[model samples]
Target: MTTAALGPNRTSRLAARRGRQRRWHRNRQPIGLLYVAPFAVLFAMFLVWPTIYGFYLSFTDRNLAGASAPSFVGLANYLEAFADQVVWRSMGNTVWFTVLTTIPLVILPLVVALLVNLNLRGQWFWRLAIFMPFLLASTVVSQIFTWLFNPDLGLINAALGSIGMTGPAWLQDPKTAMTAVVIATVWWTIGFNFLLFLAALQNIPAQIYEAASVDGASAWRQVFLITLPLIRRTVLLVVALQVLASIKVFDQIYQMTGGGPANSTRAILMYVYDTGFSNYRLGYASAISYIFFVIVVVLSLVQVRFFSRKADR
Candidate 1:
């Protein structure tokens, strides 16, 4: 055929293919919507509506016990939050806890994962032993640690006493209270990060290590050059997750210390709870929570951007 005649036939075929795609998409649109409808409805009802309602409540004086309706207070709640020294103190405590826990949470689990990945005897037992703590409920973990850290009667103090050393009250004193909580949190949650790292490590191709071995690379060298570089993405994910989890720490502190020793361990979430439920200042609590929500969102965005740039490079 001549070039001009062939061009028209190709154009018609392309137009027909486009028409079929459009018709197929139209036919499947209802089914696709049906698949997503349940999740969409739940998200709107539970997440979206509550978020909007909470934001609205932040601008009002919604006393829990008051018989009257919530009164519009504009920025009064926010202004009060800024001036509240307790709020600032609680925020500082939360930041300190995050700093204290982030290092161990990110690093120790990696070590455990590496150890478990070794071709050792009874590897399954080691994996199960390390990960069992993570399967326990937060309350159960707290209770276990509570007994272990009891000032005079605790096993920790008893162990110290045998060596002529006195152990400081772990959960009672302000200096050691947060440290104790951090220890318990690390023990309880490191399993999760361990599992994440183990999965990532296992996904690494065995042939890469074999190639390194053929090149006379030692085990340690292979880990540094081949394994670590490949799992950089997983490491970043674990760090980000640990940071966010540390920031929102509440259950352990609440169950263990109750923000005691003059509110030294009062995390931001605990402060919010006290304000909303204990003090019956729902509006003020909402303002504080919204402020925290913004901080978390900003931190998450920063982490995402940092990882994206690292990945691109």
Candidate 2:
């Protein structure tokens, strides 16, 4: 065949191959979707539907005990939420809790992971000891700490007595209420972050450390230059996860303090619970929840953008 005729024939073959691949891909897509269909159904039924219904409820005056059907009140619930001092206070407490817990959750785990990763005696014991608390259910952990924080007979107070010092009421005193919660939270959840940091540490190549050692870099210097830089992504991930967890803190505080000490430790989620279930103000509670949800979503987006920029660099 002439070169021009051969070119047209080759083009037709290439087009045919591309068309077949496209058809195959199109055919496979439905199978892929079918495989995911169960999960999608459950997700839509539970998550998507509830979220949409909750958002709709936020704009109404739906009381569980009310005789009338829910009537739309436009922005009344949101406006009330904005003016609600308790809501604002609870939000402040949530922010305080997040700030108090984030540092320990991010940094302490890294330190513990570093220690456990060392060639020490009984490393397995140390790993188990650190992470065991994380495996405990929130109720179990809270009950344990409740006893420990007891003003008179608790171990913490007893230890203080041995030192000839008095331990203040932890769960009851307004001053110490959130502090006690923060302490329990840090102790309980640090293990999960520790395991994550340990995993990240293990993935670091030993040869990198050897190269640093050959260059006469001190251990601390090597950690600052090599270890931290390599595990920066993991550190960020732990921080983000910790922040979200801290913000959504309910079970521990609810079980331990019940938002007591004049509601000093009342977190946002606790406020939502009180509004919806306790007070029967479902509509207002939903509004408050949606507002908090928006805040969380915004924070997640910001974190994602920050990491994306860092990754790009």
Candidate 3:
């Protein structure tokens, strides 16, 4: 064939190959989409739909019974939420709970995990014992703690009495109720974070510690310089998880405190429940929920920013 003719033939073959590849790509697209369709459907139905619906509901004046007609009052519910003293009280309570719980949950678990990782007797038993609380249902744990915090027959007060200490009426008194609830929450949930830290600790290579030892570094110095810096990612993860979880804490406060003793322990979730169900103000409840969501998002962003800065350093 002539050189020009040969070039045209080669170009034609190349075009045909490209056309085949394009057809194959088009054919694969549907199968890939089909594989993901279930998750897409679920997300739309559960997460996306509810989120959109909740936002819509927040703008209207809907009642719990659905008997009254809803009137669209743009931002009125939100305004009411801000003006309402109970909402602020609930927000304050949630912030207090988050601060009270997050610190202990993040720090105590790390300390316990460190202790467990060291040479100890019956290490696996200690680990299992430490983690046993996480296996129980939240409601179940709350109920058990509820009885334990009971004023009259609770073993906790009895133990304190034996030790010459007058135990306060834990669940009944507002001052003690919130504190007791926080302590129970910390105990019940700390195990999971502890295990996470423990796993991160184990994944650190022993060679690093040996190298530190050869450099004549003390144990505490090794921890501060080597172990802590290396596990910074996991520590950040634990802190983020605890902070978020603590902010949204509901079940323990619900079951144990009932946001009771003059609503001193009423969290944002409890306020939402009271507004929607108890007072039959669905719109107000929805508005408060969105506000709470915003607060959570802002706090999460702060955590992320701090985490990023630490990582950069």
lDDT tens readout by residue for model 3, 1-313:
5998899899999999999999999876768778889999999999999888889999999996878689999999999999999999999999999999989999999999888877579988988888999999989999899888888889899999999999999989988889999989988998999999999999999888899899999999988898888899999998888878888888989988789889889999999998999999889899999999887788778888989998889
lDDT of 3: 0.90
Q: Each candidate's lDDT (Cα)? A: 0.93, 0.93, 0.90
TM-score of the candidate numbered 2? 0.91
State each candidate's clash count: 0, 0, 0
| TM-score per model over all chains | 0.91, 0.91, 0.89
Clashing residue pairs found in predicted model 1: none
Which regions of candidate 1 are displaced past 4 Å? 1-23
lDDT of 2 by residue, 1-313 (tens): 5998899899999999999999999876767788889999999999999899999999999998798999999999999999999999999999999999998889898998898877689988998899999999999999999999999989999999999999999999999999999999999999899999999999999999999999999999988999999999898889888988899999999999999889899999999999999989899999999999999999899999998898678
Ranking by lDDT: 2, 1, 3
State which candidate, 2 or 3, has the greater TM-score. 2
Candidates' RMSD to native: 5.9, 6.4, 8.3
TM-score of 3: 0.89
